[model samples]
Target: MPRLADKRRAILRGALTVFAREGYTRASIDQIAREAGVSTRTIYNHVADKSALFETVIQESAARVAEAQVEAMDRHLGGAVPDLREALVAFARDHARPTDADHFALVRQIQAEVGHIPEAALDSWQDTGPRRVQRAVEAHLARFMAEGRLRTADPHRAARHLVLLAAGEVTSRSFHGALPLPAKEVDAIVEDGVEVFLRAYAP
Candidate 1:
């Protein structure tokens, strides 16, 4: 028999892959068990049920993604995201590498499944990944404008554009299964995007 710790780790990794690919509803404990090369009894020993296992995967992935995004922003700033284009580029490029697929895909599945489970969706959204960068960007822009680094008349308008710039490509890909994008090509896009953005908001 596998050690308790080994079995648990196996379950975790297996669940992550299944969630990211098959989604929450379709991802079964049996499938996860098969993927882990363990038995269903092993998964149940670690997590009470499929829902519990789903939450566990989401929480772990969200924490990692949030940490990386926060760290990228922190490196760009002493403590705050002050400039518009710089912050947009930082957010996009950092998150664009696509870490924590299980957590992200699980959150997406949970949100879609929430309508079917009234009481459970509340906890699901509260615990899972969120589209929080929009509000964070708005707050940062407002602060910089207040201090005069930027001269934007509408922080909201700026926030919309920033979100589009950061997430548009990845969002499109998620729907269409990743398009043809190489690393150098992506970098070129980001570079030109920054120039265009600066021109639109330059002082």
Candidate 2:
């Protein structure tokens, strides 16, 4: 038998895929349970309701993306880049891959369905929502600032721009129904962005 925690994780992952392919209003717990390979009762035992499960899945996804992004950002910090542009190339290339890109899709899904959810769901969604991803970027940038690799006057504000330049652009592309840009193109964008950012923000 699978461990309860492991089973719950499976269910959450399955539910997230379904929720992304569908939406909160249309997604069914029965489908989620089926995808999770657990009975409906088991899903309920693990989560309060569909909304609760959605919140959990979304937060978990956010956490996953945060870890990867923070790690990738650190790679640029320690390397001997000729200038900010080279450092940014690595930064953008790191995110250009398809790994866990679904989390961002989940973020878009939440924005689409937030109004339909209850106050509790809304609160959970907002607190650990895509907003936390922004905070994570801030924390990572602050680390670079502490190491003297970055010269931002305010890490928090600067992080907001970085997040917008990176993830925000990808998120915006969805609005236009455009496919994800190539990884190399993303690197160029980041390289250019870093150049511009350094003009005003870097020390």
Candidate 3:
């Protein structure tokens, strides 16, 4: 059972790389098998088909991205910060950054293939990824509101506001992560975002 689980994980990792590079239409089981260092028959033993594999990959990758985002929120917002602005800037920086090179590649791949992929796959990704991140941010904002650190009538709205303020310009200027912004530039954007958020939500 352990060996089977390890092979499945290996196949998923390799599939991510191939799918990211070649995209859904071009990605082949044989290529994924080679990338995984497993036989094509072995891959077939794990997943029923390419579509199944792709869906699983999307879900797994989304979970990983969501985990990283939630962790960032907890790190910057869960605990006490001497300076809210500075802490928020740090959070924004982390939020904007990709979890890793492979994760970045998978994100780009998803964007590239979004129009081509199944609606179910897209929904799965959104449910596991962005929605989860939004919930985490909302929970953090609710905590701040309860503590009287922020004056928010609606914690959900405030969370959305903060996320948009922090991410909008950076995402646009970065071309949705296609272009990498330098650390200093990211910090500047986050600083401005935090200022705007404070103007709206601070007590």
Tell me the lDDT of model 3 at 96. Answer: 73
Predicted model with the maximum TM-score: 3
- On lDDT, the candidate that comes out on top is 3
Model 2 residue 23 CA deviation in Å: 1.0
For candidate 2, what is the lDDT? 0.69
lDDT of 1: 0.65
Q: Give per-residue lDDT, candidate 1, residue 160.
A: 65
lDDT of 3 by residue, 1-203 (tens): 99999999999999999988888888999999999999999999989999889889988988988898898778988878777777788788888766566656676777876788878877887899889999898888888888888885798888888878987778777755768789788888878888999999988
User: Candidate 2, TM-score vs. the true structure?
Assistant: 0.78
Candidates by TM-score, descending order: 3, 2, 1
Looking at model 1, report the run of 10 residues with the lowest lDDT sum. Answer: 171-180
Which stretches in model 1 have alpha-carbon errors above 4 Å?
A: 1-6, 79-88, 100-128, 131-139, 152-160, 174-177, 188-203
RMSD (Cα, Å) of model 2: 3.3
